[model samples]
Target: MRALIRFLFLLAVVAALVLAGAYYFAGRAAGPQIEIHRPTRLLGRTGTLDVSIQAPGGRFNDVTVALTQQGRTVPILQLLNPDAGGAPPDPRTKLTQETGDRIRVTHPLDRQTLPGLREGAAVITVTAGRPVLFGLRTTASSADRRVEVRLTPPKVSILSTHHYINHGGSEMVVYRVDPPGAESGVRVGQLQYPGYPATGAGVQADPTVKVAFFALLYDQDLNTPIELFARDEAGNQSRASFDYRVFPKAFRKSRIDVDTRFMERVIPEIADHTPELSVSTASADELLKAYLVVNGDLRRKNAAFIREQARTTVPEILWAGAFAQLGNSQVESGFADYRTYYFDGREIDRQVHLGFDLAVTANVPIVAANAGRVVFADYLGIYGNSVIIDHGMGVQSLYGHLSSIGVKPQQNVANGREIGKSGMTGLAGGDHLHFTMLVDGQMVSPVEWWDPHWIEDRVLRKLREARSRPS
Candidate 1:
């Protein structure tokens, strides 16, 4: 009986040892991990692949990457048999060794790199192999990503001609874009003015036709090239140029003398309205300092805020005929007036006043310049009680320095409708209405837009011709 018991105990110990050995081998057989960082969905004409690989023992035997489409596979990268001193098979594949167990690989996936590539569904596969069990066995891991290859650019064409834009003024263009829903716009140097469907402008001619309102600000050069561009979701872009003329004008420069009472009135009010600015309106010196901050920093912030608000404009023409100016008001300041500010016999700062300052009777009722929706009706930094109306197609009008606002945001109003009452609010010296025309968030001269003949010739003529012509 004792001999038989010893035999059974030995058999049990052998079985435990075999189980431990199998577990150890199975753990060692696990492969390396892979991570792909870019081109998560669509691969364009010039796309890149970023991949990372990690191995358990700080070393990988081989790594290979290939793209498969329509049942065909094309190798893009290969790091083969590093222990055998084998280099990468493709010269364009960039390989980096982060550590013994980790590596990074990047390669271009463009058509020039992969000549066999076509616009269709594709799969990117990355496989990594690491040696285990004393180099006798190879453990492997793979990662695959599905993406669409897009090679064709969107088609853009100009449908209107005889475009004339005044320096520091606004203009409109009508164009057509294939793939109707693609993002199409007018690109002027570094600035982009978005396009709206022509149907939005009440034109029932073509669904693909688009209209855009653009501007040449007081700062941009007259010769700055402007072109219409169409870009698809896959980052493919196409641009076309149309004939346009630019007329330059001389801007007037003036000096603004700052006084103690003006600072005392304006600084404290702006500071009270704007909690974002940290300033003590107690002393004259501090008031002057705060005034500078409001003029320079707060002014820039307000401009940026207006630009952001412009993004919410409806993609249609809400205004008909020319925009209107304040009734019986005299222009106290013209658009783009280069003003040099002075305090205590010394120049403090210089800034360009982009809007017209019109003055009538104190606390006079302010009216909307055109038919549109009110985007903002509140106390805006320097503008005080202000109202911004979206005239659509990226064109808007501003009625600033109001004592009271009568309209609410998103409320539609007709031309010459009362929006507020003018007062000495914001940075104003006296009761006035600061009026301007905004083209795609850019402040432009409202003179042209206020003229009946200019509106008919520059804007309405193009829309009429586009609707009358065959698509």
Candidate 2:
């Protein structure tokens, strides 16, 4: 009886050991997790494929990625354990990073990288595995993504001629893009001015025809390269050079004297209104420091805000005639005036005055420069109590230093309509109106828009000529 009992106990112990071994080797049924972040829907002619892999306890041993199309497989990346001796990896496979338990891979999917690649539906397969069952077997996971390949670039060409742009002025370009929905524009050096449909500009032309109002900003070099560019959704791009000329112009330079009283009035008010500047207004020295910050940093912020407002303009032309200048007003400061600031007979700072400062009388009524919708009506930094009106097609007018605004945002006003009352609410020495014209967010010479002949020759004639031509 004792021998029989001993045999039963040993048999039970052996059975438990076998079960424990099996559980330790094949406990986890799930494979490594694979993630492909790029090439989700469409694959352009040239793009990067980003992939990540994670294993149980970060213990990946093998990973493979490939692109499959039309019964052909192109290997992108493959990583295997050196101990698991196999054939060498393909020369094209590039492994970016490999940690103890995770792996990252990045490969370029381009014509030069992958030859014989055609435009069609393709599948990217990512497989990852980790050692299981004591290195005898592998637990693997896979993910497949289907994407469409696009290789052809969008076509772009100029449709209108006589594209003359002044160094500090604005010009309009009429062009055509093969794909109407493609984003087309005028590229002046690094600055991009977006194009709108010609129909919106009152031109009964083809849908693919676009009109863009671009500028040769005052700061840009006189010989900056200008060209028309078009880009499609798949990242395909093309450019075309048009016949254009750049005329050089000279700007005025002047000196501005700052007084203690002006600092106390302007600096304190601007600092109080602009808390983001984080400037101290407790003492005279601090007030001077705050003044510098407002004039430089706050001024740039205000200009960026105005540019953002220009983005929401309507596509069609809203104004009918030349922009109207303030009546019975004297131009105190001209556009692009390089002003040097002096306090106590010492040079303090210098900045370019972008707008024309006009003064008629204290608290004079300010009117709309043209027929357009008021896009912004509020207190802007440095400009103080300003209003910006959109005249459509990337053209806008700004009226600053207003004591009170009568029109609200989105309110349409006719030409010469009174919109506000001018005052010294902002950084103004006396009650006046700061007016300027913006072309595609660039502050250009408003003098061009104010002249009827310049408008007739530069803008109106281009539209009429483009409309006369067929698609």
Candidate 3:
């Protein structure tokens, strides 16, 4: 009887050990994990749903993903495989996968896929299986998340009808958009001119409506399409087109001769500032290269910085009439001039001069061209000592290569107020001011801004007309 009892006890202990081992392997097995990337918060009516699927050790035998909103379950994708999708065997499906580690899922989500999905939270559940019972069975789902869906787009309309856009100048547009919090702007090519809350002048800026001053640089294609765009938090987008009157004009072209003195002064300055020039000991060829770098590479970077500074502007009309020009000054160079540099009688480089070069007495007073809040008053590369004044509604003026600056950032200056003095500090052949007018950071013709007639007929007339209309 005792021997039989010992035999029974040993058999029971062995059975328990087998069960413990099976449980241990099952514990290591993990369910599918989902990382939702897109529709981050509010899903758009017509947008994409991006997610990443991951399995720790083995592949999933079965995978299922579904979206549940208002008691409705919409299936996204399902795959039945023994190997938790270590390597993807199929294309067309975006499942970022590395053999045996993780997988991803990125699919389009819109009204077509998720019927009746409205502006609210929706639950996303993912279930994945990994063989744990000696490669015999799989585990259950381990991921569940929520996504916000927004299917409605913001309403937008143009208030200013008459828009005068010089082929390479700036203009202002006043428009209204519903849902005061929605983002609205004008899109030209890849660049977007943002909308700001209008303020200043006698006119009150409405929260839903704003006036944006934007630019048309000479570099941009004259025929490039433009549109006014608005979008809400839900990624719903709307667009509107306005009647635009384009004025075309020819730009000046000139060949500038490079002198020895000019090269020596500019090249050393370039090498001192730009580490990429790679000319510890300046040679003729290296000096030319440095000059090109400063003209081409550095020029573009400085322009981008200026654009960033001009992005934030007041909404109200600041200036009263035409912008002021420097007194007793002569036009040394014209705006939108196509310039070619000749070195040793050979054409070395070419660039488009975006600003008018005004020759004035050395260290003469540099005044504000119009009444505006000083947005940027600092040293800018290539332009040297520069000051940018924001004339509200995305309209701004750039005064470059100044000898001295008398104003600080955020300070308000009236038209003809002395802000600085002219100088030959940056890439300038002589003491002069590089004056340019910009709309949304795009260079435009300054001639129109200087003419009171143009302001009344092209810009202010439309604003007056818009305000006179019934609410």
Candidate 4:
């Protein structure tokens, strides 16, 4: 019995030795290893920084990282239980065979955390570890990473006209440049335009390039010294300054000679289509009376309508120069003959001249000044075969005494498209095209619609730039 017991004890000791050797080798294999990659050593103080790290085989927890500049450490980030409200205390920083393990961590530097560390070299340190696992203590590890932050001059340029008066409203200026290559992988911070209302500045990507920038506007008067600034990924900044002067907004005025007789003839037709009048007459005297009595009212009503139809939103194509001609001197004798009369320019002794006279030659194609739906395309009164297009917004265009009508009523016509041929159709004297523009049934100057630059600078640009200055 004593000999059997001795053999069993020897076997037990051998088994214990094999198990201890296996554990020792495993612990050695799990030695703590850490790697830190500082891809971009030079960073813009206000821009973004990207850091990468690699740790083998161990889970990283409670990692606290900071950027150090001039002996002061600025906490970049701390990885902790998000539920804990704050980062946990650092673990012991010793590596041992029994507790050695591997871990990895990465961090992104942005504007908020790198405020004071601009224009200097920065050191990044990471502390990582976890609590005891199965009653075995583990050692925490740290790695030192270095990066250089530099301040770069900004690129600033004037987006608006080089010279502008204090119009006292928002003026848009676009400033842009290519973003840092590192920012290509992620969304960069919002671009802000200083010295302007917060709502007025916004960041947008350039349509033609990978660069992004802010479109900022100065909505208030530049009475004081104004500075323009831009910021980049590493928080680098650039700025420029310009002086502003208060000057009267520029405007131009010119007088256009209008033939009142020609205007009077078309007044009745325009008024007949107006919704406000509700009643109209074919008599020339009666029409003239309505025009004189309600001329102001008609202008107000029609101005609203005509402005709506004006091609003021964008630029318009204009016909250059004016073609002058004479028309028939007598009215058409028959209803089928398309007879119309021209009254003399004077209000008194309005003599009837035979035929409608246009300023263009016979068969000259007439173009519609604006886009609209055609409402009339037939012969009536003294107008031979006439065409009327109702361009919505209370404006209408009439091409009268035409030799031929290319469009029918209810047909859609685009701006500057040929709609009819000019002719002396109604009365018999000479051949010319009678063109007219009507607003709310009253004839204003047709010259305004034919001038592209005038409409843009005067009507469109001025309105867009106007500041609500109290009179």
Error of 1 at 237 (Å): 0.6
> Candidate 3 on 297-394: residue-level lDDT in tens?
88888888887776567766678899987887899888889999998899988999988899868999999998999988877778878899988767
Pairwise TM-score winner, candidates 2 and 4: 2
Q: What is the C-alpha RMSD of each candidate to the true structure, in Å?
A: 4.9, 3.9, 3.5, 20.8
Query: Which candidate should be chosen as best, given lDDT against the real structure?
Result: 1
Using TM-score as the measure, which candidate wins? 2
Q: Point out the higher-scoring one by TM-score: 2 or 3.
A: 2
Ranking by lDDT: 1, 2, 3, 4
Better model by TM-score, 1 or 4?
Answer: 1
Please state the error at residue 411 of candidate 4 in Å.
32
Candidate 1: minimum summed lDDT over ten consecutive residues — where? 81-90
lDDT of each: 0.89, 0.86, 0.77, 0.45
Residues 85-163, candidate 4: write the lDDT tens digits. Answer: 3333333222222222332333445566566766667777766544334324434667776777766654653333233
Per-candidate TM equals: 0.85, 0.89, 0.87, 0.31
lDDT, candidate 2, 201-272, per-residue tens: 888887899999999999999889999999887777889999998898889999999988998888878777
Those runs of model 3 whose alpha carbons end farther than 4 Å from true positions after fitting are: 1-16, 19-21, 24-33, 53-63, 79-93, 97-104, 116-121, 128-134, 198-206, 273-281
Per-residue lDDT for 380 in model 1? 93
Instruction: Kindly state the number of residue pairs that clash in model 1.
Output: 2
Tell me the deviation in Å of residue 178 in model 3: 1.6
